[model samples]
Target: MTSDGDDTTVLSTEEGWQTIQATIHDARGAMYTAGSTAILLMWAGIISIAYLAQYAISTFASDFAEQYPWFPGPLWAALTLPGVIGSMTIGHRAGRSLSTGAAMQSVGIRVFLYWMAVVTAAGLLPGAAGLWNETRAETIPYVLVGVIALGHVLFGILHRPVIAVFGLGYAVSFYVPHYIFEGIAPAVSGIAMLALLAATFVWVHRTGEW
Candidate 1:
């Protein structure tokens, strides 16, 4: 950044990078809020459909578990599919250029979806196949932190502040799941999530970047 009386100086490469990051940080907030809303809508639709499916089975169905076990109810509530899609949509709109929006955001969001799809497929596999191996789910954060966290840094390398903000959301996703799923405690999990989000919100506000 340079200064000339009453005239803004053009940013050099490094300063331009900072400017891009600030823009992305603003964009991420919009994306998350939009994504959350989309996911809630998806939850409503999924629950409604799942309930109807169960009703049909109850009314005229037979051996439902033998054929249609592993209802998508809990999966619907998990909210990853819709959330990831919604986030991706926002990311498309958030892109700095077509390259970032089309190539990067699209691929990143699809990576998340692919991950979930694979997990679901595994559950559908023959033999002792289901997602509830406590030990397996326990490793989710580690896998994500190792892979997704690195993905964040690599893809968002140009946008430091944006990645930092998104990282907060990502980290909270990991920690909250442990309390909510492993501990089977919602109250504690909710508080932890809210507290961390609030702190991040305050920090963002103080920074006045977004």
Candidate 2:
């Protein structure tokens, strides 16, 4: 009963609404992405600054020890560990889905592993000096194993057990030369950690888990 021109007009109106809805949806998605990225980057940066400050203060004491026959305190700079896992886990769970929650759970497991194997041990470092000097090969391996274990757990190829094994291997292989070799250890560790994170990001994107 409708004229041809009337049908055409009705179809055009429907298409316009569909287009508008799509545009709005796209805009919302972009906004969320931008906002999340900014917040995480800022949070991570702040955490990094805090970690560095602690490291610097720790360095001051250790340096004094160097001149006065002192030694690094029982602390090996622990501030960096908390925010590394804490902020990312918080960011992931903010408005994400069940899978992200699960990944973060695994991350938490790794962190617990670090705490048991590293932070607690860091507290007991003073006692270790009595057993062996820092310059000895024995102590270096222990430090590397603990710190590398932390890296593997916090930044894994997946939220699976394989990453933990790899991390353990890395810890075993770390030598003092690497730790003090022109300050490359820190950079290398950072990159390796990022590799795991990069993989996680890919997984999140491909699966739409984020």
Candidate 3:
């Protein structure tokens, strides 16, 4: 006893739900794409800055250590400051562009804050020790590797298994450079970390999975 109008209404309702579902699917994909692209670009920028700074130091500051022993500290700050700012800006814009769930974004923000706190504590420990003693600066890079590895593990907990596996691999691979290049362990560790991050970013870009 159903009329034609009732059949038409049912079809329209089904079509509406399908459209909504499709839109949600597309939005999720967009969010993922944006995140991957942002991380890729941000890490690439950091890598470029590191290499470029090394070039500048070697070319222009060959005798800097003799005259100004504190030169490397400022140089490192110069190199890191931009990378940090640029990465945050890139991530913010990418996340803003896609209409993702607010609850999910809040969770991500909280996790990121926790990661930052952990890393900050790691960095501050060496800094405090350095203030107390003279030779502690040399340990900063090695400590950073540990901190970064921990952050990646945190990401795996909050995000996925792949990052956790990468974290484990990185933690293991990090010690090689420290032991091999004792005099320049920090620089070597930085370069090695940049390479690993670049490789990870490339894989993410190619697969579109994080």
Candidate 4:
């Protein structure tokens, strides 16, 4: 009877440890989700605004574009800088709330490096192959959107299905507009992305999955 009791106590202790670990895992996931969701929403707004602005400039400010052919590059850099800073801030705050904050931050840094590598490859490979030029400048937006969509899809496949759906929505938004309403593709894609992101925000809150 004493041996059986000892065995039961050991089993209970193991179960308790397992439960504690699961709770910690869930908490980490929730924190990461909260940080990531905010980052995604912020980027969605920034990117959509950039797209809309591009459309407006190209359509209503032809003189400006002609006078300053380099304006778009500067504009994008200006707009993107804030998002980058904001993302880092959000991630840092989220990390601080976790017990393993340093480790979590390290992981985040590694993930960021992975994305940088992906973006670098995307740019370098095309440039090296002489696939990008002034003649195909208009395709730059499509390529950027494609890269973002692909990243989202891969992220979803590795982490969550919902993200993959967002990726699909982004692809469809741009592609459908490109083929069917080429003149307004930028506007349509921007609006679609904003709408999709808004819906995702609502869904996450309602489901409490994040």
lDDT tens readout by residue for model 4, 31-89: 44545555555665776687778778878998997777656666766887787677667
Highest lDDT, which number? Answer: 4
Ranking by TM-score: 4, 3, 1, 2
lDDT of each: 0.43, 0.43, 0.57, 0.67
Question: Residue 154: error of model 4 in Å?
Answer: 1.1
Per residue, candidate 3 scores C-alpha lDDT tens digits across 69-108 of: 4554576567666655654555555566554667434433
| All models, RMSD in angstroms | 9.6, 11.7, 6.5, 4.2
lDDT string for model 2 (1-210, tens) is 456657643346777899899997764443233223222223223322433333344355766545533233323334444544654454445434323555434533443443345444543553565633544422432453455456445544433344455455444334333566554554444344444445544654676533
Per-candidate clash tally:
0, 0, 0, 0
- Comparing 2 and 3 on lDDT, the stronger one: 3
Error of 3 at 98 (Å): 3.6
Candidate 2 global CA lDDT score: 0.43
TM of each candidate vs. truth: 0.36, 0.34, 0.61, 0.77
Q: How well does candidate 3 match the true structure in TM-score terms?
A: 0.61
Winner by TM-score between candidate 3 and candidate 2: 3
Question: Residue 192 of model 2: what lDDT?
Answer: 45
For candidate 4, report its TM-score: 0.77
- Looking at model 1, which ten-residue stretch has the lowest summed lDDT? 35-44
